[model samples]
Target: MRYLVAALLLASLPVFAQTVAKPMNDPKTDTFLRQFAETRRFMSGRPTKPRITPDEKTVLFLRAQPTSATQTLFAFDVATGETKELLTPEILLRGAEETLTVEEQARRERMRVSAKGFTGYDLSDDGQRILVSLSGKLYVFERATGKVLELKTGPGVIDPHFSPDGKQVAYVRGHDVYRLELATNTEKRVTQGGTEAKTHGLAEFVAQEEMRRYSGFWWSPEAKHLAYTESDTTGVEKLTIVDVMRPERGGNTFPYPRPGKANAVVRLGIIPIAGGKTVWVDWDAKKYPYVATVTWKKGGPLTVLVQNRTQTEQQLLSVDAATGKTRLLLTEKDDAWLNLDQDFPRWLEDGSGFLWYTERNGGPEVELRKPDGSLAQSWVKPAAGFFGLARYVDADRTLYFYGDPNPTQSYLWRVRDGGAPEKLSTGTQGPAHEQFAHVAKSGGLSVATTQTATTMPRFVVLRSDGTRVGELPSVAVEPPFAPNAQFFQVGKEGFHASVLRPRNAKPGVKLPVVIKVYAGPTTTVVRHSMAENLLNQWMADKGFLVVKFDGRGTPLRTAAWERTVKYDFATATLDDQIAALKALAEKVPEVDLARVGIEGWSFGGYMAALAVLKRPDFFKAAVSGAPVVDWLDYDTHYTERYLGLPQEHPEAYEKSSLLTYAKDESKPMRPLLLIHGTADDNVYFFHTLKLSDALFRAGKPHDLLPLSGLTHMVPDPLVTQRQYEWVLGYFQKHL
Candidate 1:
């Protein structure tokens, strides 16, 4: 996938200790693919979604047991570094099987959360209570008493939040916003009108998929009113996907905005906690229709970031809670487009100023802005490798962020109220080390997650003085073997690529090459984490040299470099991969470049099919999974950002489409395999069908595999194993 990867392996056994695999041409005694699937690509049992308590005394996180995707809440004491489990699904369900509503399933799919049982939680302001949602029911786990109670909520609830004072909880049910008083157990509907065409308090499709705004509602301080979104999908396109395998089960139909099509009309409103008339927030809806993000905090006014339909311009607006009026704090405009950074506009507790990260200065920099929106201080100089704000402690007047000189790695950096930025997480062994520091709001308590080329991932506790506390524990199942790979900068442009040869290959033996290409703007494939290379190693051991490349259009670079493929995705990225492959052939001769096969999924899958079609001399075969054949068929936000609206830039869409090449009967076609899930909503299965239809009309032969009961992400372990085997087998027969 372009936005995601095929396999995510963060934890592994002590196989990195060995420089090479034992014995020549040796196959792992235990199939790495089997362990990978059974362990959920080693993502199970990994600690995630951590929250630091207000007192800086504890850090709470959610984790599952080994080989399990069902998670539970846990707390880590900062003082003694002692860990304790707070709640489990087994205890809460009481032998009853946890069930999810269709709404909950769709919400998890949008959030990319495949895990079950406490996928997320909300920590109460005072740190005395924790709120979790399970099987569509809201539950509060009292920290002091170690008790869990279900709230008096109606069915089909998602995206639950707590009132600032921790006295009440609010959630969305049946497309409308609702609140429940914790003390009295009273439930009140905040909004009255809701339907399938119009919804309240939940994010729209593009907001969650492209803009990264998950929640459609925000609560004002003191729990006086609720600010929420009302989306009207009256004229938006309604698409349906059939349950082809299980015809009796039916399908799903929802609003999906295609390129140049009408998007859901979204507007904001504020309603009292006791349920009264809503005061709609006013803005220029025609100019800035996209609400990128919203924030309503204690010391700051109701703030929101709104963007234009094309995403070329955005404005930070400060809302008046009483009057429901807004004032433009700042306006940002770019020639190409603006990439939304979710961490920006962080409000300070004193209400003196806020931090804003903008690329208008050529690179990303954290600038402290006054209440009037003028710059007060620039915290860090503009860096091309700027990741984003990690943790901010307004009480201590300090910030911890992730950035590094290398784009393939992220390191933790710290800055105080007046001092310059300091590089924390010292003792780095190599450039492949990545660090993320989760600091408490009160003080300098940080849980640093550090991953090196040698280690999987380790979470260590640290104090303000850089004193070692202890480690946050994990029960991730280790893999049978480590990836035998080498990462380096290939070609003059320093494009990041990794080549994993068979661990048991001899010095002079030549092997076929398989290029794993995900060359899309949404993902940066070449990272320091071992999680990215496990699948590459498995492919290498299948008697092929697995090579991966992150070419042009990948993020974490200058706008000039990334926008090279602005209107033409088919030319620039594919050219970069071909050039890099030529350079690699000269650097390492153990792999035969002439026998190259390309494979990818989603946008990567588009490139895989393009490589074999457009460059038949370079790539012998391809395996394209869920590829987007036409940019015009994709969503509005992601597609319009690069190629503009289909109405204006029709040539760009024509040039970037895979069907354009597939229709050319004059070109020599290469062996190709197309795989897609019939029920895929995002990059729907119709994409593959279109390509196959075009190929058939062009008298070209190709293979197709339609998976049933799967979406864009095939989360089933057994299916993943069988699918990979089929892919490997296909390459062996064709390449």
Candidate 2:
């Protein structure tokens, strides 16, 4: 009996061993994983540029290849899952021949010898034509027959916009707005072009970046008038950008208004659509720092949102269309900075009133007001979550909007006809993002739905009542790259951290950890979504555990969490991050305390640089890109929000400045990599340039990579690739 029992135990022991010894690269598992990775890469490849179609029946999107070398336009039916390819590189090159003359073709051939091929284009309002600019000249393509029409046979014609009536196209040529009548086949200048001395109908550097505004003009709904802003830079200081690569050509000095410096004087004007004299609107000439938001009302007044120089106070003014008389409707003031909404304002059917978004009561909410400025109703009350822009307001008076009810995720909510709001969909644990397209006649909504963490983004059509009508076809599945990634709560403050582990990580393996952080008031890094950040993945693949946390001061969370770091922005946010990290290091044994690196860009970059300077014992290395080393160095609109005015709180600015905390000659800190573009007008290249000198004076060893001609966003691919390589090399050497 004893011998028989031993035999049974031995058999069970072998079965247990087989179950424990799992293969690392099982064929079925690897195939599924590869497919999952491919799916993610494919979705990432989908062009995220805003899609706007004429009839609103289809969405015109740009699709790019995996390598991002080839891109084409695709039309996706909003109602159906059907998709049709509209343009490709080969097709565009073939169509270019029909549009260009022999000499013009030869010129483009010469230019293409070194230039990257064209990729972006805009479709006409009727959806039957597309205006594509390749090599330089604008070419109009007939979508049905694939024929081409040469609109402007010239050297420079950029950013073309179709007229509302679809009979003409307007573009920027030589810094002036130019109109090209498609029917008459004639070109006319809308404004006198700007030279070295003057700039007309085009935005300057500060306005474009800090204000989050671009272009100089907007076409009226009737297509008979063009409303534009003219910026006079006669008084603004000029910052010269020297091009060392082509020293013989010399450099250009642009009107760059540094902090506390004089900015351009701006004013609004309306011009005849055909071409005529300009009519300056009724503006307060004393208000030199006026910013305007012009929107055309159906048959009534034109709403213009105006702000003062300091950007602390904003007023919504309705202007009489014919008389040009302005009347102030509503006013909003913020102790820090008033938020601006660039989206199209919602107007009622009768044109008697409209909806406005304000944070007057602490949280961003909606308010309905009459044309005379009196409050009609409270459309949305202040809540814990932030109220996003209203997507659609139905005739039944139910307002549909997108907002993060919880800091970690966003959901669609519908406020009944002047009633309380209700969550629409089944709330997911992770982040959920919904983008809507308005149904033309019925005012219904179509959405591109995506749930993060486990599910992929899919398109869905929803009824007015928020019921799903149908689901569009899902994209091919990609391999699981960051399956271990999960959002962990940091406490009741709604603070959370996104944690990702190495793919082949084993229990008890002490791996180096990297924290990609952005502790800012306007942007949040951690959210519920399937989108994989390339930088985070690269670090994880190299055996480093990557984590991203949205501490206090980050936006999209509760008002308290966002405003907690108000006066002491960097200090409070960094302390929260370090506290979270220490807690994580103690709880997760896989995290190695001896090896920790921090990285970020812009505001995040500011925090990253501060992390190593303030907490060198916790952070080993830091990589900062275009960081605002000093709060006073940044623009008024963004910096003032958290730190308040420099005069109001000088100590806060001094403490937050990275330069102020530079190590003494004997007391040094961790290795730091400081990167900036030579022509970064947004944060100013002087930020890193000044910091480099400060670090040198302090005898701290650091590496500096100054990219030439790169802007704040770093749009150049070569520069971006170098940035990635530098970040990886820094972590590899130190972390």
Candidate topping TM-score: 1
Model 1 worst lDDT run, 10 consecutive residues: 10-19
TM-score, one value per model: 0.94, 0.82
Report lDDT (CA) for all predictions.
Answer: 0.82, 0.64
Q: All predictions: root-mean-square deviation over Cα?
A: 6.4, 12.1
**CA error at residue 294 for candidate 1, angstroms:** 1.0
Candidate 1, 113: how far from true, in Å?
0.6
Cα displacement (Å) at residue 380, model 1: 2.2
Backbone clash count for every predicted candidate, in the order shown: 1, 9
The ten-residue window of minimal lDDT in model 2 covers 13-22
Candidate 2, 1-735: lDDT as tens digits: 232233224223111000111223343533432333333343634443334354556655555554343446666676675777766656656745424332233222222211224445666656788777765567777867977787753456655677767778777666567788887778888876455345556655555655556556767767877767777878877766554345576766667654455667776777786667777778564652556466764534667777776666877777655556778887777665666766535677676677777767767777787768788887777773544654544456666676665666666677765578776663345456554333323345444455665555555555556666554443333434544566787644435788777777897799988889888877777766655454465457667889888887776654555777766866778888887776776667898878989988888888888888877888998888889887777765566656666777788788788888774454457888777766555677778766766776676767666676665655455555545655776777777
Clash pairs, model 2 backbone: 33-479, 35-478, 35-479, 36-478, 36-479, 37-478, 37-479, 39-478, 431-528
